[model samples]
Target: MCPRCRGEALLWARVPYGWTNREGGRVEGRSGVVLCPACDARAPGAAALITWFHVHGRADDEDEEFVRLLVRWATGVSVPPLDEHAPEAENERWQRGDL
Candidate 1:
């Protein structure tokens, strides 16, 4: 989050990445491709991590530890691998209501 503007967490989706939000508007940030939805705060995010999130569908949404580590990752900081959160953690979210 931006220290000046208490922005929310960094969110990612399968959206087109452009230089500006709209009409070539200038954003105030340095060396970060990822943008915070609330305040447009820029944070460096790795492609590998983003790919992981896309493949896993944010399975650790409710995991506090995961969220903290995610924030760290967003800031271009190194964090340990998420071994605690295995594939099973995402199973419940994947089950459709077909029954």
Candidate 2:
């Protein structure tokens, strides 16, 4: 089970390093050491970038975007963490204006 989220066993998921959100704005993906969904309680960096950049190892020539992300993450740089919780989505909150 995940130690961070503490739910299902951390599945091998494919998360992007960075991408353009629905609004066409660029989103930055951190390559720094991230908290493991599990095992961190037992040890830090346990996940060892289990699933951050390039899932299958390295990026291919055809997928130029992957190559870029791979290099960006491989630089061995760690950025400060954002501990704040994400704000609720506008639609998720029902407002009186909706009537």
Candidate 3:
């Protein structure tokens, strides 16, 4: 249902690199904060997204795409592109286990 242990792998791999709070870490200007171990494992994806942003000149674009991919991975449903004025129905369905 969840891509065969993807969530477990992400969480377990990320837990160690995660900081309990944002105040004490070396401030790298990265928007999505993750633990070093998880970052290392997922570096390729992260780098690809960064490259996409660099070419497109839209920083938020990569974050938005990442969230959509995460949702699809977690819930096994394709989410429609988000709009600022509307709530995301797919998210609701995901929470309700309808997907």
Candidate 4:
């Protein structure tokens, strides 16, 4: 799940097909689903899709940030707050390994 959009439900099943980098490099990686959040409030089809960018045997943190920013820009809504209503965060008696 994207750290920015913590509250939104992520669709982590959309595989990334391709990606381009800031240095004009194109790369491919293992096919896997993307983690994304839907912005139904602003638009019906607004979504932030997280994709992996493998460049020169390394993944850039900037690229990941860019994807996150892109999603917010496209959706026009701030990423939902994470764990705002989670029961675990609010529970004081729950132990880490209680489950």
Over 1-99, each residue of candidate 4 has an lDDT whose tens digit, in order, gives: 544456544443333344556687875533433234333323323332222222222334467665564455344433233343577554643665444
Question: What's the candidate order when arranged by decreasing lDDT?
Answer: 1, 2, 4, 3
For model 2, where is the 10-residue window of minimal lDDT?
A: 41-50
lDDT (0-100) at residue 4 of candidate 3? Answer: 40
TM-score of each predicted structure versus truth: 0.25, 0.21, 0.22, 0.23
Judged by lDDT, which candidate is best? 1
In candidate 3, where is summed lDDT lowest over 10 consecutive residues? 10-19
Error of 2 at 57 (Å): 26
The C-alpha local distance difference test score for the whole of candidate 4 amounts to 0.41
Clashing pairs in 3: 17-35
| Lowest-sum lDDT 10-residue window in model 4 | 48-57
Model 2 / residue 98 / CA error / Å = 25
- The sequence of per-residue lDDT tens digits that candidate 2 reaches over residues 46-91 is 3344453325554354776654544443443344443333333444
Mark the regions of model 2 whose C-alpha exceeds 4 Å error after superposition. 1-16, 31-85, 89-99
Those runs of model 3 whose alpha carbons end farther than 4 Å from true positions after fitting are 1-42, 61-66, 69-99
- 2 or 3, which is superior by lDDT? 2
| Full-model lDDT for every candidate | 0.46, 0.44, 0.37, 0.41
lDDT (C-alpha) at residue 42 in model 2: 34
The digit string of per-residue lDDT tens for model 1 on 12-53 reads 423222244456684443333333444432335444444455
Clashing residue pairs in candidate 4, if any?
14-34
